[model samples]
Target: MGSRFVNLLARSCNGGPRHFSLHRMNPANLFHPTRSAVPAVQPLADAPLPPPALSFGWPGKKGELAWMNFMAFGRTGNNFLAVDQIGRTFFYDTDSRSLRTGMPMMCKPIMDPISIAVGDSLYVMSGNPGPSPGKHCFQALIHGRLPASDTNDWSWYSLQPPPPFVNDIPRFHEDEVKSSCGDVPAPYEIGAYTVVGESQIWVSTAGAGTYSYDTVSGAWSKVGNWSLPFRGRAEYIPEHNLWFGFTPNNLQLCTSDLTASSEVRPPVLQNMWTDVVRPKNWTLRDASLVPLGSGKVCIARFFVTHSDNFEDMSAYKKRENFAVLEGVEVLKAGWAHLRMVKHKSERYVFGRDLVIPL
Candidate 1:
């Protein structure tokens, strides 16, 4: 067993009085299904609420955990897949609250790779390969699958790279390129990706364009000249028949009808919500939306707390890191209006570990 998993088990066993109702309980408490040692003679009506399920850390030193890319996998969405810059893979099962090492990636090491989960399989796309003089461009596409029962049988296989035109988009003027010796333009990186329905994986580039990859035919096709309105991974909400994701610049929670987008037009954002009121000094580092079935979603935001000191900004004692987890329920208010009810919010002091939903 991984050390991280052991630590989680220990913490769970030592937890104080907790409610039996799963709805009000912390999701992390569900990790370990072990019953309490001493049964309560009578329910403590005023028992303190348990800590958020976001306390555990990843398997790495401080700062190293930020380099890894994470995605929720498996049929129950209880397993999380994490891959680092050096091709190392880790599988974490929330049901068992255990971490297991998986096979290394077949492609070269990618920094902040784009990943998406479709059914039981996971697909990874382009990223910065390395920092060498000529190897600084974004490239590579591959995927891996979970074994039916044997964990050791898990592995990855290479897939065809995106079309060459994706990299031909000019980043600088011809005259400027001709004047400079080492000012080569880097290839376009993935801006966002989501699985459409069941067989199609839609990808949007930074400014190049949008494209679709057919998982069944193993073929790629151009979607349109415009890019997806949101960034990173978007989750499909079956109840609303729309995809929910964060807007590119402001990190606002937004939803769009991807089915309406086509080669003739771009995706349209139907609704947006300012779910969190953040401070000016706090820098938003990352955000993810995890759908918890039945029109409910969890939003996780990681922030870097900046110091008031302007001079000597690099001082070690000037900064702190933390994360906020908020729950929201989306409902239909009328024929055309959608209502979002914000629930309780939990804050935790962030560290090297990445708080991705299992």
Candidate 2:
């Protein structure tokens, strides 16, 4: 995310010391095909595991834990903002390893809401409200800005809803024609979103194309009839001048020049790498890419195991719930080539608890 580089030492999976390139490159040639090569997956090194910096479970009641959905957004540095299904908010600081309560949201419970943090403000958008048969279920936009001081109160305010996807609209009988705009259903869940520059949030939805929301003016405008090439949140790195994120279908690590995307052309994948080789029985639940500054990154992936053969409910209950953390560094070779060096891999079990990186 930042352009500055730090001198960090890490060992590659092959047990050799790997140095991350600190040389800065021209932003204009960042996406040129001749400037880079396909990255190879190097094995991870076996190293001493570090002590856990923080550990906590669902912040909601035990009864609500089973059904409650949790989402987290990195506010700044080590500070993270978390929200549960019941609109409760929690703030966690990784640097201090402290967790504190925050002002609750004003909106109703939204399942698996999409969230992003830009500057001092955090935003939450479309999500499934609930299971209402024959009725639409989607939430509108709400955002909260960080208080300037400890004595100031924190709060969430409503914003204009995003434009709806044409295909996501529910079909109605001819006799049940609606009369007003309120009759139309809410928009579908967003496919992906990322902060552009320092003030604009770019959101992409299937069939609805792409749109940009200006944080300063609180205005939304159509960008193009195309969706973002990546899924979920894409991290923009100034060092390489590229946005890195997971591919939509397979979740492979990929990079693209998001700013180069236009009304007629979608963002093209400049480079891609298979960071993890998952097994057939291991189903991926969620994945996140965390930037550790410089050229270092941590890939966190949550998975659940399943049986190949038919099993009883009791046998299925015994399936393992675990997560894998992979450390990697993007290095510049010579003047044009780029390489991804695998550093370490660690796995942890969390039983039935859902784990996500902030």
Candidate 3:
């Protein structure tokens, strides 16, 4: 058994409370399922070069804040959109290596939102109305476009959230759950899923299930059950035909065919949340998937640990840890043909994939 699964079992066995949070840590990291349409031209033996290390500039600026609740990165051509916790949006022209200020999202006091870039346009799903406590804006999907020719002019556009999705939210709403249980209920959790060549963005609502938004047709439809449940994020390996979800507990996989099939086709592969990655003695902080231009992916998991002896709780440190996993068909269980590349670093910022023009 993988150490992560064993560790979780050990904690439960020892009567340590297992709590699930939608946030990163409590479930701190939020991930959007995305695909890079770039094809793998070479085999594993002649793996293409890894992407350049991301340059965020200063330590405490917009993109570098350690404590930001939610942040997402997306790029189209040479333009990179870095949206941080404070609703501030900055555009980076990768070609020029220059940063420019962009319009801020109108929705203030936003909860967890999903940001994605399609072509030269950026889409943000802000699920609530602004500045109101507990006011769920279940029907709003915000959009922004990076200038193609007009560099000086760009703003955010708002679109109605898929009607069926908005209407259905009231059914499994948190307020009803709390009232029935005679206590506060866990917050509603939302996660986004998408692919590079596909226009649909699949979103999962906690008490509810999975739903997909068609960017091309501008419609939403109720999908099936979520394949894997995690607090952090998910990544799609285009070459492997797999989607991987990262959480504090374990790493899981959702096959591409499984995601598209309305009914579970292959019994073994149906709802197959395969455990692929696991690390011992570390609390999973956040993770991002980077495609290494091969049929494999580099999974960077941020882990934090305190002194084992419990001498002082404040003596905690974060580490940058990563591993590369090659895609393979393992019929039974557990990840096969996985390789761990040792990396040691103290930097613990959120990691993400950025495709730049070569």
Model 2, C-alpha of 78: deviation from truth (Å): 2.5
Each model's lDDT comes to: 0.58, 0.58, 0.38
How far in Å is the alpha carbon of 51 misplaced in model 2? 8.4
What's the CA error at residue 306 for candidate 2, in Å? 1.6
Residue pairs in clash, model 3: 23-27, 23-28, 24-27, 24-28, 24-29, 25-28, 128-137, 139-161
lDDT of 3 by residue, 38-93 (tens): 23331222122232323332224434432112233343222445444455666555
For residues 112-205, write the lDDT of model 2, one tens digit per residue.
5666777656676654221131121323223434557545455666664433344444554545533323333333446678888988888776
Number of the top candidate by lDDT? Answer: 1
Model 2, which residues run further than 4 Å from truth?
1-77, 102-104, 128-151, 161-187, 312-315, 333-337
Q: Which scores better on TM-score, 1 or 3?
A: 1
RMSD of 2: 10.5
lDDT of 2: 0.58
Which stretches of candidate 1 lie above 4 Å from their native place? 1-69, 84-86, 102-105, 128-152, 161-168, 171-187, 312-316, 351-358
Total clashing pairs in model 2: 0
Clash totals, every prediction:
0, 0, 8
Query: TM-score, each model?
Result: 0.70, 0.70, 0.54
Clashes of 1: 0
Mind giving the per-residue lDDT tens digits that candidate 1 earns over 193-244? 8889897888776545777887777788888878888878888888888999
